[model samples]
Target: MVPRVPSPRRPRLPSGRAADAALAAVVLVLVAVGSLRSLIGERQESWETTALAWALLVAACAALYACRRHPVPTATFVLAATIAYYLVSAYDGPLLVAFVVALYTVAAEGRLRMAILLAALGLLLTGAGTLLGNHDVNGVALFMMTGWLVGVVALGWVRENRLALAREAEQRAASEERLRIARELHDVVGHHISLINVQSAAALRRLRKDPEGGPERAEEALGAIKDASREALRELRTTLGVLRQVDESAPTAPVAGLDRLGDLAAAARRTGLDVRVSTDGERRRLPAEVDLAAYRIVQESLTNVTRHAQATAVTVRTEHGPRHLTVEVTDNGRGPIPLGGGSGSGITGMRERARALGGELTTGPTLNGGFTVRATLPCPAAPLAHLPGPGSAMANGEPPRP
Candidate 1:
């Protein structure tokens, strides 16, 4: 036996809280070391003033740990601690790093207005305190600080907007996947289940008519039922397998398309309905999505006829154009077609499938008191050289009467 290959494991990253704590620790060390350099240099400040500055610098850095969770409060605390540290220390340190991080968190948390107000307030308070202390801040120094404050807040705001857009896109993808699964299950299970119901009913009717002779007829119906169930199970397994597939690198099994219309027609014929399938225009390979949509529309139309339409005859037609494929299913059933053009979810699903592929579907009572489902789908195949006109000899594939 071949050796099984293990899947590659994804690298794990630090969680939000752990990352925040790590950031705070790094900031504390950097600020503490940078501020302590003042002691080695010539310093006129007293020992008490130096000790107070170190404590405040550590508090400012530590506040970063709670920045994301309580952004506004953390920003306010860090701002106060940084301001106090600057007032007490003779030399400026990198304590502004923690203040910048806090302001960014505030904006990143979607508190944009508050973050801006806090940023402006920090600049104003720092300038005022520097002036009152008889220490004039140079024009260039104030300009650089203002630039840093504005840049960090703007960056945080951009991050928030990006995160919002990402969430919206993720939600849309999940919703579309749900709809796709619902449509697939309806088409796969609904069609075969309806056929099984009809065959089973026919089998029961045969047995009731003639107990002894009915065995042969009932057996045929039973065989048809078995076939329908097996097909249903097979299609269901394929759909569920796709949903459960963890490895996208593996080859995907092909789904039913227009090529499987023969199988679909065979299943429908078992219900004693004259299901005739005909094609118009050039017949060639179509895009996978288009093929699947066309097949499902036909499958659902046939299913509706089998379950609801009491008519004995139905025609399935596919018209191919250079860039378009039109599918029509008409049944000579006397069943009432909902005035709204859709009786239930099956019709709705068929219309959705067509629309999803930039196509359209129409369902209504045909002029001859029959129900009809028609869909127009865009195909990427080459255009047909000659498309049949309204007065064409074989319009809609129906033979012309001589």
Candidate 2:
């Protein structure tokens, strides 16, 4: 199996408040020195008048520090200071900078509806004030205000859209987890329950024939039932452990691997099936997850044979390659054999396990009047690793054949 790529860490952004302090300091210098108007226009106003403008500009810019914590109130204070300076002062460099930043914060952090209403109200008030005072409204003033206001709102909208998409992705991941857990519960319990039913019916028939010998047969049936119950509970607890929040001191049970196949085959033999197992190449170790998946496929296949297939013989085979491994389980059963028919949920589950590892599974009725399940699982390695092609002979040097 290919190892999963680790997720990247989120990028860290510099604090906006740190930048705000610098911006506020720059605004203070420009307004106090009265040098801003030299670039925009000549500031012929007196030093006393410039000092008043400086006071209002400083108040507006200072409020920016609190915009994130109390966005609406801080923005309102900045707006009032801007209007006071706009109405009387000849310079507007610092006030304009503070005004745009405050509006963006209001939209980003606080109630959006209130921010929108305030923006519209300020626009109308500025237009009306300009008209009443007969100031020029068709020059650089109109274009600058329009661009600055619209840019702030657009940035806030983009941020909101990204947050919405992130929330939706988290919800979808949660739903998929629920479906996965449900499928695990079904597979673990369903096979054991099927075995229990078959054993119980046989015991009933024996009991109705002779009371003395019947007790012995019934005792055997109860023993099988107890074993099945314990197995189901153990597997359920092991699989469902992921859902618990509490930490555990007990060690987790190791997952079942291909090494347990001998015991599995022996169990099937007890259930009246003559089973055989064979390997085609060097039996090197597999990736942990791939080994577990192969074991489950073999176990499920044998359970299907006992529950559905009427035949008395079966075969389990494995072929190991340098870059991949193939597993097959075949039984002499009739076509469309219940859950083991190679077309129901059981086959779908097997295919899912293979596909998750970039592999595939195919199931069909063999020409020998039985059903066959075959799966190929991949193993990933570095680019430098040399592996033989599919048509090449095994490491044993035998000629390749289909």
> Number of clashing residue pairs in every model?
1, 0
Q: Each model's TM-score, in the order given?
A: 0.87, 0.62
Whose TM-score is greatest here?
1
- lDDT string for model 2 (31-91, tens) is 5555366334565677777777667777887887777777888888888888888766765
Candidate 2: where is the Cα deviation over 4 Å?
A: 1-144, 209-211, 250-253, 337-344, 381-402
Model 1 C-alpha lDDT versus the unseen true structure: 0.85
For candidate 1, the per-residue lDDT at 358 reads 94
Least lDDT summed over 10 consecutive residues: which range in candidate 2? 388-397
Itemize residue pairs with steric clashes in candidate 2.
Answer: none
